[model samples]
Target: MSKIFEVPLYPYQRCADQDQATPVRHKVVVVGAGPVGLALAIDLAMQDVPVVVIDENDKVSWGSRAICFAKRPLEILDRLGCGDPMVDKGVVWNLGKVYFDERQVFGFNLLPEEGHKRPAFINLQQYYMEQYLVDRVRQLQAEGKPIELRGGNKVVEVTQDDERAELTISTPDGPYRVQADFAIACDGAASPIRTMMGLDFVGRVFEDNFLIADVVMEAKFPTERWFWFDPPFNRGQSALLHKQPDNVWRIDFQLGWDIDRAEELKPENIDRRLKAMLGDDISYELEWSSIYTFQCRRMDKFHQGRVIFAGDAAHQVSPFGARGANSGLQDTDNLAWKLKLVIDGKAPVTLLDSYDAERVHGADENILNSSRSTDFITPKSEISRIFRDAVLDLSERYEATRPMVNSGRLSVPCTYDGSPLNGDDCALMPARTRPGSPMVDAPVPGGWLLDRTGFGFQLMTIDENAPEALDVDGIEVKRLALTTPGDADGYLKQRYLGDANSAVYLVRPDQHVAARWDHYDEAAVKAALLKAIGR
Candidate 1:
């Protein structure tokens, strides 16, 4: 194994008791050291929020799980200060091909636009992702940011009320109690905190199991997503192939639920499958393998009193669309800012409710797309198979029917169209950049438009100078001169301003469009900011 895949165990330290005299209390207690939890903790710490993360495991995830990350998540990571490292260490790809048996049906590209800083997707091991996030947390700690990570610390019991949450954490030494103003459950799908709170995740249970194998080999395969249905190597089932860093290849095989788990996982049984796909000429070594079942489910609510849920703890999706971890990262991105505001008293506690609403909307979009992709890939009934086959057959001949053939709708950021935080839309403004949509990246003078917008509310003005600094607190005013160095080539004007020469937009901390106007309006901006904070 390469050094990049080596698992590093973080030493667990003894924490002071909360039951003792003058107990310590944390502003935020995150109940998982996984990627989502670490990312959220790091984001909060960057904003000077005191956060402590606890996890049962001392090391990162062992195998290559959740390897594909989309552009949106990369941008979110960039905002959190860990994007460049991940992009540098991972394989970048924007092209994907779909195959019907041995014949290629069609191919597509994700990065059809230009001037974006990050690629459409990158393939890196989950361990590396977690490690990068952990490193970011440590860097913040060194800067005197109150971010504490406790590995080997497990939350055995959890209880939360309206104002605070009390948790019993078990370490190597013994169990101790800790309290926090708010508790975020980034724990995996089997969340103990969620179960303790009597929450149930309700959705579809797929009847199929997928066998994923990460093998180390040097093959002349293009760095593109290749998905096959009823391929010759894996008869009557679906298969997926993608490239990972350190010459590792991730291969997934769709196995029916009836197969013997033990029998299929054996080296010999696994060898047969790989040999059939790669041929006897290619030699490879298997690094890891696992079997997983698909489930698209989520809790009835993400927030209950002072306890909240993010990532897999809140929802789950089929692996077909690579929505699992990417969406989880988005959950934290949408949440960390809101949590920080509430903790600082800049916003009411109800601001957290918007996090729940927005993330729930994102989860539902992911589930719907994932479920459709799952159905298309592994048709459950005879009618489903017939229609799937028909679509596949027609895709080769007709371009019109090609859109119906969805191997997997690759992950994309969901827009909170009907979100309560959205403000009134400017009638003449372009609909694509309207309220509730993420800020589209465009080339600016020195960097990208997104790079110019910092971690607070921003007032973006196009084609004209931004109005004089407002008295509003925590809002940054940014002016963009279109056709100049600020927007040299006019892409920003074409994409954002359209035919209008001057417009002002109120962007939220998370970079979503809060409101837009033909001219800057102080009262409208104030109202939009208030709505964004869930007032």
Candidate 2:
């Protein structure tokens, strides 16, 4: 017999003893062991940066909080050495259908392209995501990567100056003070660091409420997103249905603001609601349920002097788009490389400032899309509802109107259109693989292009016979030639090049395109490298 796959909750050990004499200074201290903080720690550890993560809880998230993991985040997880397990254990989904009352309106496919390594989205419980990240961190620690996690340790106070930041952590045993050259506040939406620094998270708080429930049932349901406006059983309200692993299902029913929360959560009331949605004959067991009202908000800046913020601490959007955790993981992806370069003294401290600029831009984009989805689900006025119904009715026949029915514009990686670090573009180059966009995947020898591009700067070129002896500090060069094993399909040439033969692309450590050129220039490459690293 084999032991079942159960998420382990490690016990909290006393770390306050180490701070008794002289404070042990660390290179980077991460507060909060949530998905964002853990992923960031893993990324920095892979880059050989010492990291200590402190969290107030010893267990994974209590419920199935964030279930949808998008492709961009899965790619980031792949770079962190844990993507395969997630994909193996998750329920992959790409297509979603929208319905108005009882009629099907329109549908969309998230990843319509081929030859990609990962799927459009994977619905794994948030607990499983955290468990996998913690396991990866432990594996890296066994190999001496200098990653430390202290659960049940909460930060009581945070103070920072230009040189360093100090955190006062309280545990069951006692309290201790730890100092670090730089600290990241991943402590969640009600962040102590954000409050201590007097930063305001400015955005709109939606008036509508939603009831989310997780159920265990042995039923055959299509593994696709199904959303309905004014569903038949749950009259005059919207409902959503999705499938997850472990014979579990997630359902969300829209509830207006004026309902009594205490009465709605009663077992009898919840049973009646579940029976209506799942039907009278379907047998199911309730796993967990919760009520929530979301807000679309973020701190104006992610970094404040020596203390940086990521995840729910820096920004949060409505749960409709699945952007909450996906965007947060992207935050760590953008920050880890820059922070490592800054710590290694290879780049100026100003490089960290770009993390602030780029991630804040990403946060704003998520908030905008979340707001639009909320408005469509719960129309503000009678006129707005009339317009929304008209569009849904038209979407059934016309392909053009399908774009207007917003059942949460699913999460996609945001392109940094006007980023300060973007370099000049070549007119002849393909637009999809241009500067400031995430690198498009193409077939490569043995695997994919992204497999070779890890957590470091890479210079990619399609020129077969490029020079082999060019030396640049901290930057790896990969050449995709026609003679390579996987280039037989010509995907590298067709997707990256239209009619041109070859081009040089300066790719950042985060796998985003920094710059591209028709021909390589030593002087131009060095300048773009410097600009990319924030010289």
**lDDT string, candidate 2, 1-535, tens digits:** 0012243365689774455876678899999888999999999999999999999888787778899999999999999999998999999999999999999888789999787899999999888888899999989989999999998788888888888998888888888888898999998888887888788798999998999988888888789999999888788779999999998899998998898998888878878998987788999888878998868999888889899999999998989989999999999999999999889888889988889889999999999999999999889999999999999899999999998999898899878778888886777878787888888777688788888886766667776345543446765555433332447877787767666666777788899988887777767777887888887
**What are the lDDT figures for the candidates, one per model?**
0.86, 0.86
Deviation (Å) of 418 in candidate 2? 1.2
TM per prediction: 0.96, 0.96
- The runs of at least 3 residues in candidate 1 whose Cα sits more than 4 Å from the true structure, single-residue gaps closed, are 2-7, 17-23, 473-485
In angstroms, the error of model 2 at 275 is 0.9
Clashing pairs in 2: none
Model 2 regions more than 4 Å off: 1-8, 16-19, 473-486
Clashes of 2: 0
Residue-level lDDT tens digits of model 1 in 1-535? 5454555556677766634665367799999988899989988988888899999887878888889999989988999999989999999999999999999998889998888898899999998898888888878888999898888888988887778998888888878888899999999999999988889898998999999999999999999999999999988899999999999999999988898999999999899999999999999999999999989999888998888999999999998889999999989888888888888877889888888888899999999999998888889899999989989989988999988988889999778899989996876777778899988888877788777764688778775556545545553444433443467677777667766767788888788888888776778877887887787
